[model samples]
Target: ALQHYHKPSIFNSDQGAQFTANAFTGTLKQAEVKISMDGRGRCYDNIFIERLWRSIKYELIYLKAFDDGNHLSQEVSTWFRWYNRQRPHQSLNNRTPDEIYYESCL
Candidate 1:
């Protein structure tokens, strides 16, 4: 599955079971990706992901109530699109993340 998809040259995460598992490691290994793990008790090393979850909970999840898994799946997908392409971020100089990323690629 990973072989068919685009893979990053580096994958960084905490030392969680899923990341530490042989199955996951094997996939990264085969794809020649370097795995970087944060040190023990060092969540602040990745403050961006932390801020993202906080923003998602505060802006979207806390405000929405879903009746079913299907509804939730749909809404989360919608939320991701809005977050990436529509919502302006002060940190990105009021530009959307998609805009900044695409321009950087060009």
Candidate 2:
């Protein structure tokens, strides 16, 4: 992710073992990224991501039958591209996420 996209100022995640692991946190620290972990039992802290997952599941996953992990990953990647670059969100005033994100970057 650091190679393909600009490094984020902050990385947020649940208190999962994979995220808390030294190797993972160390990499983020090396990149000068701040880490934010949600409080235990505080699912609302990540509501936006949770909504995204719900959208992915309803719009893509539930509709498709994947042959394997590779296929699933590929399709999901395509869906994400569409989601970010093409799909407009009412919450974002009908602008695609890419539009809002790049606009904010400027």
* lDDT by candidate, in order shown: 0.87, 0.95
Candidate 2 global Cα RMSD: 1.1
- Candidate 2 per-residue lDDT over residues 9-72, each given as its tens digit: 9999988899999999999999999999999878899999889999999999999999999999
**lDDT by residue (tens digit), candidate 1, 13-99:** 888899899999888888899999888779898788878889888887889998999998898888899999999999999999999
lDDT, model 1: 0.87
Residue 37, model 2: Cα distance from true site in angstroms: 0.6
RMSD of each: 1.9, 1.1
Give TM per candidate.
0.85, 0.93
Candidate 1 structure, TM-score to reference? 0.85
